[model samples]
Target: MGIKIGIIGAGGMAAYHIAGFRQAGAEVVALCDPNEAVARSAAAAHGVSRVFGDAESMFAALPELNAVSVIVPNKYHAPLTLQALAAGKHVFCEKPPALNALEMAEMKGLAERNKRTLMFNFNNRARPESVAMMDYVKNGEAGRINSAQAKWVRRTGIPGFGGWFTNKVLSGGGALVDLLHMIDLSMYLMGYPEPAWVLARTFDDFITDRTFKGPWGIPDAVNGVNDVETAAHGFVSFKTGQALSFQISWAEMVQREEVSAAFQGTKAGGMLRRLYGADGVDATATDLCEFYTQDHGRSSNRVVTVESDPDMGRVRSARNFVRSIEGTESPLNTPDQALILMKIIDGAYASARSGEPVKL
Candidate 1:
């Protein structure tokens, strides 16, 4: 039989997870959500036969499940993932693996001790352009990437304003947590350096500005509890003597959104963009990977054109995780890498609050 999978959330991401898993040849047998209506609806839509009001009930109901996709909010990642690991199920967790390094480390330990596969949904890493760029770095073509800059800025895209996303206690932080794809991919392309320090800043200027609320915005009390920053910027120095600068914003006064990662190396500089879909669903345009360097004492620019997966690599991520559980392949993004990311995020937030560089 194929992998028996369960989905632990009924949100937008959960829908995508279910479809991706099915496409990867997994049987999505069960789904769980605190909201009964939501869970039922998702189950019906996905042709899943089992639905539960909570993860505990689902866990008890489906003892034979081989794997689970934890697609809930940031606050519940640790608990849900821990529960899944305890149940001897391979876990596929959403990004920012957990709220902090400590929580992520605990989950990692549990997965390791249980001898189960644990993977992060850093699906963007599977993007053909990302794969190509990473190959360049790994093959010594991009030769010792020493400096990098990544940014994901939106003109007005506050996701679910006045909701858990804006609550620091629930979501950790806005923009930074939601837009971490850029930072994660940047670090991966830079060879996963060991961060030494972080200096950062954040702002909340557009939370109350209703004019800037876009498609993903929601209405709530004007003075709702929005304790997180709408935008953030950080500079990280790695022990390898390399450095990275990153910035992200959910709402900002800008002409258009910017999503790109540029790396400077001793041999050649490379830039990659469109790592994800335009609307984060499907790729509208092909990925762009460009290289710049001096050839024969003359500046030259090369655009490497390669075939890219039309699915934006989402399918690959889901399939690879399942295959890893089947012992067919190894995971590309593991909890240990996510732990490194968490440390950078924690340090960035700490530095933002203390106005001093935080040592990792």
Candidate 2:
């Protein structure tokens, strides 16, 4: 028997999912979106013959679908995932998991009760640079990481003026939630220790500034809500006595866009970074991965080289999801790790609001 897959939310991310699943040898049977025309267009483009306007109709019509890929908005991730899990289907969802920790918990619980695989697209973990760094960490060459720094800052990079990315209710938060890859990557390399507390602050300095819109081409809404912060800085302490500091922003007064994660371990330190010529444009980015250690009591820096990923592991991560379901590979991220990530994000927002540290 082969893996039969259905996709929910026929949007930009769904195209990536379709490509990945097909590359993994899975049969993409159907695609669904609220807009019937969009769904039909995507299905035709992807070679899928079936199309529907909603998830309920798709599920009711297709009984052989054992798995689903969810590429919807932040607000629909949980409900759609729970629905799929309850219907006895494995699920692969996009980043941030859900709006907050509570929603993530519900999604996790339902998946467990249904005995289905639940994975998130923490695609950075599948990047060649990240894969190289993990080999060293797992082999004890990096030793125990004591502290780390994660950053994804851009100098004029708001996604849109009034899209869901800027609405707190729809998108949860701003850059902190949308650009959470580095934070999750740092924690993964550190063995995913339990987080204890978070102290943070957020700024909306450029939240309503149209001049800072990103180059992605997502059009601005007419008279739409834009209430999310543009920047967030925070620190997290874990139960293992390790710590992580992060800076995430869509708009800030910076030299250029940078995505990086640096960690200091007991024996050595390492860094992985991508410097971009322009925000939201992957073609203009340069990547770096290196390790710092001692060679005969002298400082030594070794550069880790690998083939560059144009999609930043987006499609590769999806293939991993399919392979994991086939029992040929383990998932790069688990539901429990996603829950922790959301908890940290939730804590950061709460701390920012109360002007004090939130103890998780």
TM-score of each: 0.93, 0.98
> What is candidate 1's local distance difference test score?
0.84
Cα lDDT tens digits, model 2, 1-360, are: 889999998878887788788888999999999989999998898899999998888889999998999988788899999999999999999988999999999999998888899999899999999999999999999889999999999998899878788888888999999999999999999999999999999999978878888887368999888999899999999999999999999999999999999999999999999898854445776778999999899999999999978888888999999999999998999999999999999999999999999999
* Candidate 1, poorest ten consecutive residues by summed lDDT: 276-285
Off by over 4 Å in 2: 279-284
- Summed backbone clashes in each candidate are 0, 0
**Model 2: lDDT to the true structure:** 0.92
Each model's C-alpha lDDT? 0.84, 0.92
lDDT of 1 by residue, 14-35 (tens): 7667767776688999988999
Top candidate by lDDT: 2
